[model samples]
Target chain A: MTRVYLDNNATTIVDPKVYDVMSPFFCQMYGNPNSLHSFGSETHPALRTAMNQLYKGLNASDDDDIIVTSCATESNNWVLKAVYFDKILNGDKNHIIISEVEHPAIYSTCKWLETLGVKVTYLPVNHDGIVEAHTVKDFITDKTALVSIMWANNETGAIFPIKEIAQICKEKNVLFHTDGVQAVGKIKVDVQDVEVDFLSFSAHKFHGPKGVGGLYIKNSQELSALLHGGEHMGGRRSGTLNVAGIVGMGLAMELANDAIEYENKEVRRLRDKLEDALLQIPKTFVVTSRDKRTPNTMLISIKGVEGEAMLWDLNKAGIAASTGSACASEDLEANPVLMAVGADKELAHTAIRLSLSRFTTEDEIDYTIDVFKKAVIRLREISGSYAE
Target chain B: MAKNDLIGGSIWEEYSNKVAELMNNPKHRGRFTQEEADSKGFKLIVADFGAESCGDAVRLYWLVNPNGDIIENAKYESFGCGTAIASSDMMVELCIGKSVDEAVKITNLDVEMALRDSPDIPAVPPQKMHCSVMAYDVIKKAASLYKGVDMASFEQEIIVCECARVSLSTIKEVIRLNDLKTVEDITNYTKAGAFCKSCIKPGGHEDREYYLVDILRETREEMEKDKLLQNANTVFGGGTVAFNDMTIVQKIKAIESIIDENIRPMLVMDGGNIEILDVKDSGSHTDVYIRYLGACSGCASSSTGTLFAIENVLKAKLDNALRVFPV
Candidate 1:
């Protein structure tokens, strides 16, 4: 069967150009970038190019710090735990605020922090899966250490008002952190423009290698280090660096930024076509409309069919999709994103997220339309939920 | 190569082939209309059951030969995950050609076994096991509709832990067979309170009338009491003595175990607890003397409801003459 890949929000396929650039770093120029020997000094020019590529990709100022880590999870954990060390322990500010629809890295971290005398306030989202700035304003106080929210939701793809919330955090003299795992390559992200203190991103979410990620810190802020060792990344994050992964991720960011127009034009067009054809099915509703969400994501729910069963049907047809974040798929709980958006429990189980990429073709979208419709129709008839 | 290799291979590997096959091509997934049943000259029975844990529901259809009280055909409509669809298909397959009374004997265990690729392997993961349990529940709903009996009539056994389908008898039998000591031993042997842990102790996700802590204490007491009776009988000749004939040592042991297992946990939750000082068998009654600890001693209502609860547990478990007095 000719497979159609649609679950890009979970992870994207590594670009061939990135693979080509990384292959030489493994055997030919394999040396520790931190070593003083010439064998290591030979990799300096490439490492410098890679680091500069990341800085230009996210449009971070040269004076800011972009410490590379293993993945976005590591970056997110560093931001939350570092803020806990900096402001919560030494000062009277024991409070932190975050959105209810954050990824598990942010959500579960905040939950774990509550056990250590940290007061966490989970800000609820509206029916469209949006967290407003005024709501954050209502919760902020002198004792609040940080306001951490996501730039875009992985499940619903609903983009938040990061700029406005960053402004509020600045006025309240609180640090702002945005998880940019889903937003970096899928939409426009400029660290200088948004003015967020910290932004965490992963490489694999935007056609990069799996093992490398970066955290952008504005103006070299005084956040505590998560890993204390050798002076790698200016003593912020330590340990030996993954040289090949860093090189591939840097080039991948450059390529993804170069393809932003193609993502907005071609990828969005294909996603809209798939969404329109699916909406023709009975009892289907999108979680957030196209204008409010990222251009490449469509989170739809069919009335009486469960999400995992839909994935099974799509899997049989060689089509890939997701119920929500792939990390939470093993869990049998209802989709928390949909529940936070005021959806009933029944509707929460029916959420299916279909994300597109720049590599998605028109033929694949048409084939998905046919397979998804047939699967939903057959399952509905079996469930006796077909209105007709 | 699996098609789900795009991200990872966790969920695709969790489902068995039978689940994937039936989820895509469910052969017995439809409802029989009344007209179709009338044309076949068979009685039509429709039954619906919904799982409150997940939003899954299943409606069972049985075409019964009323003369013989046999089901000629069976079909189902399952609204759940892939596991539920396959489990329902397997459930309906087992129902065909069985008599109404015999079909009611079908259990969730039987449904899950029928859906398995092999006898030794499970059809679904532990989380999705509730779907097959739902499949079994819908069968009982259909049987009740066929015989015009209440659905609760088939549920005679007490369910101690609903998550793993471990009944009260099953738990007691496992404990006795293994001579289990702690609640952890009972969990490993019977898998009763592992899933949600609500069935393990006093307060958890939901309120339960039966708990593993109390059951373990009760069964251990019975075992010890049986041993003590055997020893006493051996010292004399072969004879039997009922509850009232039990010695004061045996009586005190029972009262203390009951107090710690059933009563103390509740009191400890309120930052208060009770300590049993002694058990005195008076001429007219047996009295259990206890001292209140922490805030329970200063509270006025502890003498009334608190005393009644302790006495109620002791009397129900040991002897009717037992009374609790907080000194």
Candidate 2:
């Protein structure tokens, strides 16, 4: 069976080159990046090289800083919590703003902070999932501490106006953080270009290891450390670094960057063709913003069947897809993001996310279309949700 | 491979056949026709919690000989699972010679206890116990009908499972399905509201509505005692926990064991847990671990419900620490 993986927004296959670069670090080059001995010192160069590669990949100049963390989740929590914690202690800022469609890693953390007496303002997004610059401007108060938004939605692949939002934050002298986990490899992300104060990315989102990620804090800013332990990442992040994971992430990033042009063009073409073919099926609705979306993502909501049931049927037919946010797939609760954009509860349940990658092929798409067409037809018959 | 082979060649085949035999015996299964019940003096009742998936109901047949001569040799039919069908088989064996009135006294608790002899039923006692209660209620109803009394007239005295608060009519309506032998089977047929906990068998606990016998007196007393909150208009079913209901705690614990030992570890591998906290006796929490034993621990969707379920249950039963964990 030629398995078609169309859930790249959830995770991706680790590139073989990334694996080759990481193999030595796992065994022969196994040493704590924090250690001072020759054994550790040998691995230190590789770790530094990885960090430097990432720094360059994101267009960070000599004055920029990068902090290595465990994953995008840790980076998000660290950045959001650190800002709030620093503001509280420094007696300078207290308010935090975020888009309603931010990932749970950011939204949930900010929501969690509200329980601690921190004030947070959730700015709503338009139907296209773009946060208006005015909403950002309106929400920023003198007490505003930070504005965190995701660069690209993991579900709809809708691109938020990060550059505009970042500009507003800069004008107001507020720290800007963008969860670039979904945007980094699929789309070009230059933190300097966007003027983002902090940017977070995970390796596994782009064919690197799962447990490793990166946090970029512009070198000019003096940020507080998130984890307290043996000094690593220049005392910005603590604990021994995941040398193998870091190295893999660096290689993955470099490869992803090199393949961006070709993959983007190819994936977008295939994605559009698949979307058009799928939409030709009766009562199917496209979920991604037509003009502005990640090249690799296409979300569809079949009118009459549950997204989950269809996913299972497709899985049996060798085409893997997802419904709504991966975090809330089995919730039975409709997608809050879909709801935020005014999607009906039933439509939210019917929504299916089909994210592609450079590896996705034409035959795979054709097979998926065939499999999905049958699954949806069968599910529709059993679903008994047809309108009169 | 060897393990599956062992089960396939030995235990699995026998278990499947036994379940099949019980399930296939339709002459003895389903709602007993009026003539059949009069002849055999028994009926099969299956209550399904439809809102929940799989088994969440009390499904076992009853031997209702209203005149008190239980049919000692009556056969049963079940199409659900080994435990449910076996429970039906066991119910017939336990109550056959006993009178219908005597059978009315039988509970799902009894059927689950009877199931202790059979290991293939997955041994979820709370749900099995519910099955027992459902069987008891059906037999009692059938016995009342045989005696020219309307069982529906006494709604207050007939408590289904105290934890579930399912009514006799609810059970009757739920169990009217044809091919139910397991709680999960009932769920498929009826869609009973078993969201918060297991609805597999009917024995766990009953969530009874509080209706004062002396309404005026109780009202005056409540007003005099200034305990107005106790008499608030909460829904009359299985949502709230009763302070005096000790069995509910046991049921919750049993559910915890099933989730922890059978369902949770898989969710944990995906980083989730159905946790309970603030277990109020000492203001401490109990961290139960359900080590996923099958191919499910690594499944992605398992963790989706793991934390929320634990938190929801704990929030209902306990007071704190119902937050998400790193699992």
Candidate 3:
């Protein structure tokens, strides 16, 4: 059976072109970029080229503006911790403002910092999972060190008003960081246009190899390093550079930049069809705002049925999807993102996220709609909560 | 489907094939009606159990023979995740054809073991083990309803780990049977302290009546005592000394003399010395209070690593129940 994978928000398959560009670096062109030799010289230029590509892709001011890291989790952690520690060293700021629906990389780090006497304010989202700019403005004070929010939510796919929030931070003279992991490839993200002090994104979310990601820091901003070792990546991030992974990420971003227009048009059309067909089922409704969310994502709740049971049925039918954030699925906790939007416990528990990608075909979307409708019907029948 | 294609590859593979089969197509899943019970000439008993943490609930039904203790039929309806449905189905299957008395004897372990594809492997992940426990608790509820007795009376032992539904006897048995060394080992074997971790020790996210740490310590002490008693004639100098018979002053003098003769030289060579403060005797146990002087007073190991070393010598020389505490 052909598998219809719709969990793109979790991770995407590496593009074959990206893989082809990365292959030569694995064995043939492999060298320590830091080592001073012919082999090192050959690899060092390749690293610079990949860095330049990412720099142009993000519309960064220069190559130094991009700091490549292992994953978005690391990049997010680096930004949060670097800002917190820098303020601590200078004895200037103590407070941080972040949205409640942030990925665990930001939320969990903030929570841990709170235990260490750092004051953190979690801004709540509206019914549509959008964090209003005024809510962020109200929380900003002179003591606030940074305002970190994600550009797009992984679970709900709701696009936050990052530009407006950045403007508020600029007016307040406070640093702003956005986890642009979901938005960078799917949407046209220009760092200069948004004017965010820092931004983070991973490669795997946009058809690149896993384990390679980048963080964008605006020029003239100074932040401490998370990992300190031999001088590498311009002393901003220190470790051995993943040359092949970096090449894959650079090529992936180039391809994503080329296909963004096509993805927005075709993917959105297919996603809307899937959403409309699924809503035809009784007691089903889209959870996220239709206008403010990513074009390739839809979060829907089928009442009286558990998401895990439904996903299991979908899996049996060769359709892959997710209940909420893949990271929090093991604990089986109700999605906090849905709850932040004022969804009741049952609604939160019943939410299923289906995210598409550039590769998602029209046939795949129709099959998913058919299989998902049947799964919901069968699950509701067995759930003992549905009336005949 | 290929095993790797599942939700989480290796982690989901921990679930037995039977559990997956039963989750997809559960047997005895619907409600057992009163009409069916009347047709079979059996009395029906219904019991409900719910987990407050996850909001998962299970309702069990038993049709018992009116003339005897045999269960004519068993069925269940679970209002939770796939694991709960699978567990309830297995629970009902295990109850059928068994006498009511025998049905009560089937434990959560039996329900879990029946779902295991192999004897050594666990049927489900540690977090999902509670579902089987929910199945086990409902059987007791049904049996109590049928027998006209309180559900609490059916519990033969106290439960130490509520998340894993591990009884004190089972914990002790696992500890003794495997010669388990630590609380982590208990979790590895029985999944006792795996989830929520309130059962591992005090000051966790939740509160519990008994803790796995306390159980392991007490069980280890009991096992130690048994070992000491088993070799009572061979251990120590000639035979074990009854330190309980001595007065507090005598116990202090005995400990100080041993320290002076054997332990003091070793400490002095390391630029440290030990001094006895007091000795107190509690029933079945003795507490020796001591103070460290010189380098040992400020040393990090003096409180823990060295204290254990001191306690070991005291246990070997004194009584098995003697506990040494730094003053």
Candidate 4:
């Protein structure tokens, strides 16, 4: 059975270059990165080179700090908790600003702060899932601690004006954080141009091993440590380093940055074709922002069928897709993002998210389109009088 | 994207065509109406007896002469469903030459037996019995008005199927409809005791050997009790609670009536509508079912709406019961 995997936004296949670079560290150089021994020293050079790759990709100054963590979720949690608590206790700021559609890692954590007496003002996103620059500026008050937004929506791939939002935040003297997990490798995201105080990235989203991601801290304001422990990420987070994962992630970032422009064109073309072919099927509609989108993502709603049923049919035909955010699938709630876009319950439940990768072939896209079309026909026949 | 690619044949088009055809059919989904009636005695100068309960088992109106003979013609009117209306028409046809006592003895069982050969009138619930009893009341009333006759001392009251709220008068009217032959026939045609088996006989037979007079007296007592309960339900306002089907007061009246009328007669007839199942509360709902007896087991639609109706009425009356499911 030939499976055409398209849910890259959930997680991508590991790159061979990343694998090759990290392979030796698993055995010959198994020493902890925190250790001062020769084995550890051997791994440090690779880690430095990986950081250099990120620095160039982000256009960061030589002194900009990069602290690694498990994944983008952890990076987000660390920023929200660290920044909010630090300002509340030390900087005397109690109000926080965030976009309405920030990923749960940022939005949910900030919501939790309300119980602790911290007031959060969530800036609204336009129908396209983009928060206006002025909206962020208006939300920033004298007591505002931070403003957090997303670089690109994971479900719709709608990119926000992060640089403009960040510049406005800078002018207002409020901290800015951007969850760049969807934008990092898929788009040319230069954090220096955006000038955000913090940006989150995960390795697994761009063809590296999971359980390894980082936050870019660009300013001189010291962040409170998320973990209390001995020498690891300069005591910022505890536990011995996931040496192999970190090495693979460093290698993945370098490779993603080097060929990003060409890869962007290839995936965007494939993505557009898939979207067009899918919409050609009866009763299918694209749910993402069309003119501006992440090069590799397409979310569509198929009328008269449940998304889970369609997923099962597609899975049988060896095509991988998602209903919405992968995290929301655990409880089987309708996608909140689709709901925010004013989709009715039926449309929200019927949405299928197909995310392409740099290596996805045109042939696979065509095969998926054929399978998708057939599945919709078969499902409608089974449903009988239940029409959407 | 191109609009040309979006055009195609789909199942929705097929459904639209089917709907057009369905609209032309006579039995096409729509509302239908029916009228029903049940009354008491007949006329002439021959044979008269105590027929207070007879009218409830048969549905028709009758007039009697000074000497107890049935009068050839009598005026009749009824307000009920289609079968009940047809049952009233059938009663007039069946009793033109019968004596007043003979007409009084006639049950819904006899009317349906006559209707077996009549193709125009569909067999219905034994509401004819109640109509027959009502006919007897009118005849007695008219006789009293004309000749100053007093017969209150001879009157008897009875209750039959409790779940259906059937009384001796009610049963006589049902019998006048001429559809029900046995207790189970009542269950099938009228939805009586189908939910809880309070009226049905135990072993699938009508148990006709039981004395009708004793059952009638017992039912009278039960009716009095149910009247009280019904009044209580009215006072409390018959609203089903969030987790219950019938209100507490409604359930009380229903259960009381069922036990006194439906269950007692079946027991006397050497059969019974036995309690078989009780469903624990599920979520905010509850359900229950009872065993059918006499002829009720063979009833087709009794298993559907009739069953639910009994359960629902009881649940509403017994507000705490939640919901009822048949087993």
Candidate 5:
């Protein structure tokens, strides 16, 4: 059976072209970018090229404004904690604002900061999983240090109004950070257009190799480094540079940038076909709103059939899917993103996430719809809660 | 290639092969209809159990004989994850062809171990162990319905750890069999107080009735009592030793030897040491005054339970009328 991988939001397969661009850096051009030698000097140009590629992909103002990190998690951690640590030194700001449906990287870090006596306000989202700009505006105060929200939710795929929210933060003179890990490559992200002070994106979320991501700081905002070591990336983040992974990320961003139009058209059409077919099944409803979400994501719930059981059956039929955020699925807890959107416990437990990629084909979408319908029907047959 | 490879790779290796097989195609994963029970001449017993933490529920169906002992057929319906389905299926299979009494004896560990691919490794992840606990609870519910007893009767065995579903008897048995030294040892052996850690001691994230610290202390006391009883029997016969007939010096010597032999080591293990302060013969009863030093002075159990235990040991070894007083 041909495998249909629909869980692109978790991680995507590395593009073969990106792999080919990175293979040579593993052995031939291996050098520590910080070393003062020819081997290191040879790596500076490649690093500069990768930096320029990322700046273009993110539409950043300056190529030197981006700091390469391990992944989006490190970028998010650095942005949140660095701002709070700076506030501690200055002793002026004490409050931080964030959305409820943020990834654990932001949510959990803010929770940890709360134990250190830092005040935090978790702005609630509406039933469509959209965080309103007015909510962030209302929570702003003289002591508010920053406002951090996600560009697109990993679970429901609901896109927040980042541009409007960033404008609100600008009016209030508060820093704004958006976790653009899911939205940067799938959609067009121009840091100048949004005016977000900080933005984070991971390579692995697109078609790049893992362990390399970028953080865009507009106007070269100075924040304390989370990882301190030898002077690398102007000492903003320190460690040996992942040359091969960074090279792959640059090539992947270039490819993703070139394919954005085709993705918005072809990928969106295929996702809509899958979503429409899935909605036709009995007792199934799409969880996220159609207008304010990513083009490739469809979160749906088939009432009375458990999401995990459905995912297992889908896996058995050679289709890969998920029951919302993969990081939070290890436990039996219902999806908090679903609950934040006003879904009851039963609906949250029954929700499944299907995220497509630019590489997904029309035939794969059709096959996935057929297999998903059968799995839902079969699981409902054995389920005691499903009637008729 | 394996069919699991079609999904890209096999993360299912985290689960046992038997668990994966049973979770995919459960054998006893349907409702047992009353019509089917009527044709088989068996009374149907249906019991429902729900886990509030995870919102998972399981309904167990048992076809018991009219005399209400043997379970002839069993079926289940689970409204949860793959682990719940596999556990409920295994629970049904274990209940069939057994007497109601025998079926009720099956613990959650029994059901979990039966699903394990090997003896040492767990069949499912630690967080998923509660699925098996739900299955075990449904069995007791069904058994109560069959025998027309209160569901509370089935819960007579006290549960010390709710997270791991460890009973007080199981904790005590593990403590005695392996001579578990600390609360950490109990967690390593029986997995009690491993997750959430509210059951490890008091003042945790939640309240629990029986913490592992309390269980370990109580079990160690019981073991010590048994050892003292054995020592008393060997040193003194069935005949009562008359403490009044001896001089005060002899009484002090005998009490000192007993304390040195039996109780000192136990107290020292818990970072405490006890010293005998004074003893007075009050004609009708012997008054023994003792003082607790070191960590015991600040310990909460030192004043009440530890003092009572010391009195019991002295009473059992010497005269029944001897009293213990903390100075």
Candidate 6:
């Protein structure tokens, strides 16, 4: 079967160049960075090289500390829990602000912090699913410890005004954090330009290996270590370094950043072609316009067709796609991101997301469009609501 | 890049061959209209049931033999996941050639088991188990509309797990028979407390009178007591005698019946009547939301005297889990 993967937002395949770079670190020079032996010191140059690549890719300065963690989930938990201990516990500030449509890494962590008496203000999104910078200014209070928001929504791919929000936080003297998991490699992510105190990103989203991600800490802020034992990552994070994953992530970051222009032009053109073709089907509407969302993403809802039903047909045709709703859960919840975008209950269930990467070709896009349109027609014919 | 390294897990792989087959080409996918039923001298019964949140709905069309109450033909139109399409197809297949009562007796587990590619395996993933449950609920909806009775009447036993439709008696019996000790064990055997888990204890989707925690505890104590008695006398009784015993659903039916017999007429005599909107399990209490019709809509005694009067009547006759509210 001709497999056409358009589910880039979920994760990505490792680039061949990235895989090649990561291979040598696995069997050879596979030493603990903490060890002082020759085996360990042999890996020091590679680690420094990888770290430098990450800093340059993110446009983070030398003064900023970039700590490599397992994934963005850890980066999120470390930042939030660290704030809870540093400020919230000392009664310096007990309130935090975050956009309601944050990924579960940020959303669920805030929910857990709520049990610890940390007051969380989940800033509501507009109909466009964008958290307005002015609204962030309105919700900020004297006791506000941090304001964290997503750079781009995972479902709709709606890019938020992260730089504007960061500026507001700076003026208010409050720290700013952005979950840059979807934004870093997908878009132009400059920690200097955005002026975000903490930015979390993952490697696998940009065709790097999994189990490796990084946190960009501006000025190496006073935050508690999430893991305590080894003095690795300058004691900010404690664990034996995943040498291969780090190497792969660094190269992937560089490659992904280099393809930002190609992604904006070529990938976006393919994405728009797929989106426009899908719109030709009846009762189909895009969640965000091409200009509003990321270049390589298209979230559309087909009237009266359940998301997973459409996915099944697409899957059988060897086209990979994703839905906004939790299709796997028994308690079927409408996609909160879609819901925030002012989609109705039915539209929320019908939402399907197709995200492209630099590797996506025009031929694959055309094949997916053909398969998806047919799936919609087939599913709608059998749909109870649309049978008439 | 290696192809394996690029690709993530496929959600479609979680489904069985039977499920994918049915989902793609379901025999019972079409609907039966009244015209078709009239030509065959059968009653056309159409039923629709929507999930509270998932937006998944199933519409069942039944061509029933009015004389024998046998479903001459059954068809359905569903809007849900792939598993839902397969489960609905299997549900309608189970209904054909069976009496209405027999179809109503078909549980969600039966629907799931019927869709299995092999007898020992499951047709769908654990997450899609609720699709089978949706199939069962729609059956009750169709059966209730056809029988001209409350849908609650079709429910006989105390349903501990609404997701799996595993009843209290069945859970207890399974606990004893399989020597299931923990809540997880009961979940494995009967699938009770597996999904949603409102019936397992308080602070879930809903509160249940018979929680798995209390059921496991009480059934264990009774088992110990029965063991002592068995040691005293070297004879043992067979199991599953009262596994069919009705508890909460039977109590609900009883409560509704009492209100119909004792309370409705009295309120009607006062130029007013009451309609039961819903009876939900909230913690240890069963909250009944009602709407007073005619003169009882804004009656002076509706809050103080009449409300308590209805609550007292249901509580006095039925279980104390009943709490009456005029909505």
The TM-scores of all predictions, comma-separated, are 0.81, 0.60, 0.78, 0.54, 0.79, 0.79
Each prediction's number of clashing residue pairs: 0, 48, 0, 104, 0, 2
lDDT of candidate 1 over B116-195, digit per residue (tens):
78888877665566567778888889989988999889987988876687999999998888899999998898888765
List CA RMSD, all candidates: 11.4, 22.4, 9.6, 27.1, 11.1, 16.4
Write the number of the candidate with greater TM-score, choosing between 2 and 5. Answer: 5
Of 2 and 5, the candidate ranking higher by lDDT: 5
Task: Order the numbered candidates by DockQ, best leading.
Answer: 6, 1, 5, 3, 2, 4
Give the residue spans of candidate 3 off by over 4 A.
Answer: A44-49, A325-332, B1-9, B51-55, B147-149, B162-165, B168-191, B194-198, B201-327
TM-score of chain A of each: 0.97, 0.96, 0.96, 0.94, 0.96, 0.98
Q: How far in Å is the alpha carbon of A245 misplaced in model 6?
A: 2.0
Report the error of model 4 at residue A128, Å: 1.8
Which regions in candidate 6 have their CA more than 4 angstroms from the true location? Answer: A34-37, B1-14, B51-53, B168-190, B195-327
Interface Cα RMSD in Å, per prediction: 5.0, 11.1, 4.9, 24.4, 5.3, 3.6
Which residue pairs in candidate 5 collide? Answer: none
lDDT of 4 at B109: 45
Local lDDT at A21 for model 3: 89
What is the C-alpha DockQ of each candidate? 0.20, 0.02, 0.13, 0.01, 0.19, 0.24
Chain A, candidate 6, TM-score of 0.98
Model 2: per-residue lDDT, tens digit, A231-347? 677777888878899999988988888878976799889999899899989888776476779999877877666554566567666787887622111133456566677766546
Ten consecutive residues with minimal summed lDDT in candidate 6 chain A? Answer: A324-333
lDDT of 4 by residue, B150-198 (tens): 6452235454542243555665445446534465555555565443343
| Tens digits of per-residue lDDT for model 3, A148-175 | 9999999889999999999999999999
> B196-224, model 2: which lDDT tens digit per residue?
23333322223323321222234345454
Q: Which ten residues in a row have the lowest lDDT in candidate 2 chain B?
A: B48-57
**CA shift of B239, model 1, Å:** 20
Per-residue lDDT, model 1, residue B184, is 91
